[model samples]
Target: MGILDAKALRDDIVARLLTDEVDLETSAYLDRILELAEMEEAEHQFLNDPFDRSVALVLQLFQDKDLDPWAVDLSAFLEMFSTRIEDTEDIDLPTCGRLIRMAWQVLRGQAETLIERQNHEDEVDEPWIYDGGWESDFDDNDYNFSVGIITGTHKERLPDMFSGRIQREEGRPVTLGELLMGLKAASRISEEQNLRLKIAEKRRASLEMARERFSGSLHVEDLEGDIRRTWEAMRMRANPEDQTCTLSAISEELADRSMESGTIREEANAEAQVAAMVATLFLVNRGYASIEQKDAIDGSVILTDLHPDESDFEELSLRLHPPPEIEEAV
Candidate 1:
């Protein structure tokens, strides 16, 4: 295809991707596979031998809903299989067994790695927990001592009473000091007001840190919402009829054009939008939603009311867009 044709192809693909009808990342993987086929002379060979089932099989396999084409780990696949294939040409039993063993090892390893990578990525992408207070190293004894001092407890009588209780329970002689320490260790303040105050303080600190990081301009939630809205809009616009195009295909095309024009800001924005759309689509498909009901809703349904939690919003945004940069306070 000419440069113009490639550009056109990219536009069509992007249109499909933005419509939410096609899997963008999967489309990108298929495009890569096609490109590799072209480079390896397989494209022309498949054309000449149109009846070649392998070509169709490969393409169909890439498009399979159950298969994760992006997580194929092609480099690892090649590394494992290429050497084994090179060493054997016979259709004999021993050679076949070795190839099977190597293939199994490669597949098992790739599957394990893919799962691990996905889990790690998910953990990294999740929003940080804001418990509203620092996790303390102070023990119960210290806490009790602080509480006793604040409450004005008679230190002497309290210890004697605690020691008597301990002696009864343990069937042994216990000192007043030791009993006091034990009581202190066992005691915990169960005041709801105090806990709430600590949480409020922590939340204030978190909000301040976030504001400083965003230069008091954008809330993390707002930036995240913008990306998600853009993505959802794009998905709603996608056409399900286009089988060959995807969001990733469009992204790569946009990225190329943006690079050519030196429009870094535009490119970054485009990347973020695409990532958000792709991520949202993937999550929705995978049954990760506030409401797990998947009805055949019209494309025109407004996504504004779909109140996804912050973590989900962030995941959707990061998937479709460039990762947000945490700016250092000046």
Candidate 2:
């Protein structure tokens, strides 16, 4: 009559077949055969105009017959027809029909084989009994899932199933120091951290050298100059301000010196000049040669016999005056 009516009639026939019941009605038998033929036509139409809903219906029909709806051998089907399947916008009608036919063949063959097996079993008088679970029959001596065998002395042992050969070669045990050294060498400390540690060590060494050089016996002028320059250098490197107190202490020492007021003034001037020169040298050594000379020389030299108006010593220069030539002996 129509596709749905034909499908319903075919479904009823298949249901009866599954339950081993038969209907002798000629109208039903004719409808069932006609439905199979109609399905073949529908399958071809599906191939040409694939639709998801239609493909799902065809898939269900094939599955009802216990057949894989995509019945072509996987490799051959993929090579020859997969692109068509993907390109189609409707269900694959031809493939569905082929799948239905294959399912019927397979089911029929299986049924025949099962019938043969049952007939043979019926002839057996004293059938052997099979234990329900294979595992339950196993004894302790049988291969166990839990326990595994280990071989050799505990110190040199390996799993029994391990394929590698074990040797009894004698050797002295590793010493504690050697083991510790190996571990230390393999530790995670980075090269950059090590480099920083080295730099810190060098800076400490340089500071110690400076302390030793400055602490030795020095003329008051030389001592004051060195301490001031050292303080400035430390400051440039962002060293602690506590180091600057060393220079202050040296200044205090110079201030404490007992001398004529004139001599004390002259010595302070000489000390300031020397300090400026030391500071200039320190800056030069540290690669700041372009540092302003005016700043370096400020208040760094002593002047005598100047007017009262020139008493402010802030602007004095530290440039060394050349030694005057001695008069030839008359």
Candidate 3:
């Protein structure tokens, strides 16, 4: 498809994503899954294997703790944290109790960062951020580098938190050749699920209600109201209007609420977490109010409102709809 067509399709999907709170929540879940999906086989075995699950959990905890990415010594860390038990029929490891300890200690009291250890800092130190040379055309001097499907972010701060070379189907976290692959495959299925809605209405009353709700007559009121409505529709216990929220926070809130209501709190899988992030990103980019994540740890995508005086909408108005440049007179 053409760029414009793809953009239009993306807009359509995004609009649908906005309308349904489930979509928002699911997208957030998917984002995390994509991050975990750094491993090519991670997703397939995640649900089935405990070791893979443990690794994903460890990775998430590492991220949530805001520990150094390069600090991770996967083999050593796994050795230290794994639960050493005799292999059972259900869970098959190489030998005795070689499995990830579910509740391994990560955070220290009043510590600014995740951990105090510097096990593998030297391994991460390299002049060029990228391990493999995918982009033949890229040079050392260019400020920003794009290699085919992937784009590098932390050029100035090489081998830092989010700096790396990659080509992913969708952008989420850094994935090396043998790491995360944040592939996002959605759209047709979502549309197919919604097909029944096109003709479900036996009465026009719902249409009238929708029209009344979305008159789109007022400017400021409409914008403010939309934001408020989105906040409401999410139905989160704590308001993220002015404060930052995280996947963990939302999970805790939802779990508590569910328990209080005597409903079982089902875990939000990797896909759901990743899906929820889409909504968060959408709100950050388009929601009139500016926001930021409370911390590097815990809240990955949930943003706290910044309430900037001037915004992209204000600054880009002229550029977006510029009058035709006056031609030079002959």
Candidate whose TM-score is highest: 3
Give the higher-lDDT candidate: 1 or 2: 1
Candidate 3 segments whose C-alpha is farther than 4 A from its true place? 1-230, 233-247, 254-263, 268-275, 294-302, 305-330
Write one digit per residue (lDDT tens) for candidate 3, span 1-330.
321132121222222212233442354334543444455454223343443443434344344544333233332333332222112212232211222222122212112231221222222322323234332345655434334224545454445424465554455545453242221222444454355333333223444443343332111224433333333324443354545444334434434543565544332222122223333444556653343433332223344544423334434334434668899999
| Candidate 2 lDDT over residue span 1-330, tens digit each | 433343333333233222223442433333533444466454433343222223223333444444432221222222223333334333233343454344344444444544554555444334234345432456775344324333223423234424443332344455445545655764534444566556656655654553453333123535434634433333433223222222223232443342334445444533433343344344335332322212232211211111122322222212222357799999
Task: State, as a TM-score between 0 and 1, how close model 2 is to the true structure.
Answer: 0.15
Give the per-residue lDDT of model 1 (tens digit) for 1-330: 321132222323222212224454445444643454454343223332221222222333334445444333333333323333334332122232333333334344434544555454344322234353222356889698778867878465564554463334335677657856655654433344456556656655654553353342221334334434444443444344431223333344435544666656543444433344344444444343211212322111212223233435466445655668999999
Per-residue error (Å), model 2, residue 313: 12
Name the 10 consecutive residues with the lowest summed lDDT in model 3.
2-11
With candidate 1 superimposed using the best TM-score fit, by how many Å does residue 242's alpha carbon deviate from the native? 53
Count of clashing pairs, candidate 3: 27
**Global local distance difference test of model 1:** 0.39
Model 2 error, position 40 (Å) = 99
C-alpha RMSD by candidate, in order: 23.6, 45.1, 31.8
Which prediction has the highest lDDT against the true structure? Answer: 1
- The 10 consecutive residues of candidate 1 with the worst lDDT sum are 291-300
User: How far off is model 3, as Cα RMSD?
Assistant: 31.8
* TM-score result, candidate 1: 0.18
lDDT (C-alpha, whole model) for all candidates? 0.39, 0.37, 0.35
